[model samples]
Target: MRVKSEIWIRAYLRRCQAEGVPAVVVRRGDEAAGAIFICVDRLDGSVALYGPAPAGIEGGETERRWVACFKTATASGAEVSAYLARQSRFDSDLWIIEIEDKQGRHFLGEDAIIE
Candidate 1:
């Protein structure tokens, strides 16, 4: 069985703190099975959003890593924020994590993160 969503998120936050990277849960979702979205704040007025990897097609590879879903140009932080806001409206159960790191290091678990 898969781990609970809240448990996974808490562990992720702890890892971020241990790494000395500022991370916050912008929005909390269902404790058991909410989808997770991560926003990496590059600290340069730009942000990148990563979502859970998509499922594989028939006969395709099943294992996948987090995938980049959105990116804002330099100095477009507002745009990224607005985009996230819209997403929240659409999916209230989605968990949003904002990581403030110049290098955009989300540390989303190496085995499950491709980039």
Candidate 2:
């Protein structure tokens, strides 16, 4: 028997939601690209996102665009969370997160974050 990824994805998101995780579906344009989320499974504020592997010169480029949009937030240090939540790209589709660093890095954590 084969399992549909979209089905599993929804199940995962629902489980994450019940667990009080802050998960969101990251979309690019209007297609479901991926997601950036977090859950209680993580002790630190690590963020977990799942999507297509970064591709094309436009991969990182797309993330940069989102970074700029997320800059509008004035939080002391919650861009990762704010970004995944307020990003408008998901208004239609899912976008990929490709940047990494201490200031901000997309970490695949143990917990789940749902939107």
Candidate 3:
């Protein structure tokens, strides 16, 4: 079975803190099963957004996969905000996590497949 959304998010926050990265949950969603979106602020003018990958990508059913939300490697803050607004309207149960790292580290590891 898959891990609950709340449990996964708490663990992820701990991991980020351990790595010395400042991360915070901007918006809280369902505790059971909610889509997660991550925003990596580069501390510059650009940002990177990652959302849950489509099913049957590569990871197992119990694993959470992510994909870049933009065509380019990074996008403007305004652009990211607009995309996230649309997403929030579509899925109110989606969680939003923002990480402030000058290196633009998302810490997604092998679970992320940039497209």
Candidate 4:
């Protein structure tokens, strides 16, 4: 069984805080099983977005995998916002977490697939 979305999110927030990184939930969704989307604001003009990896990606069954949304390493804030807006419309239950860091650190560890 997978951990509840709310539980996972809370733990993630705590982890970020422990690392002295400023992170917050920009949008709340279902507490049970909502997909999570992370927005990494580099504190510059560029931003990076990470969303739940699609089915069949190789990873632990209970682990959450993420995929970068943009083809480039980073994209403009407007571009990411527009893509997120479309995603929000498509999945209202999805959760959004925003991390503001000058270094653009997402803190997703090895679960993130950039390519």
RMSD of each: 3.5, 10.2, 0.9, 1.0
lDDT of 1 by residue, 17-57 (tens): 99999989989998987778888888777787777776662
Q: Top model by lDDT, which number?
A: 3
lDDT of 2 by residue, 1-115 (tens): 2233355356656655665555454433322333322221133444333333323424343431112232222222365555556544444344432332333323334221222
Q: How does model 2 score by TM-score?
A: 0.29
Q: At residue 82, give the lDDT of candidate 1.
A: 83
lDDT of each: 0.74, 0.37, 0.93, 0.91
Q: Highest TM-score, which number?
A: 3
TM for every model, in the order presented, reads 0.78, 0.29, 0.96, 0.95
Q: What TM-score quantifies how close candidate 1 is to the native fold?
A: 0.78
lDDT of 4 by residue, 1-115 (tens): 6788899999999989998999999999999999999999998888999999998877546889999999998999999899989998999999999999898888899999999
Comparison by TM-score, 1 against 4, better one: 4
Q: Which model, 1 or 4, shows the larger lDDT? A: 4
Residue-level lDDT of model 3, residues 30-65, one tens digit each, is 999999999999989899999999988765488999
Ranking by TM-score: 3, 4, 1, 2
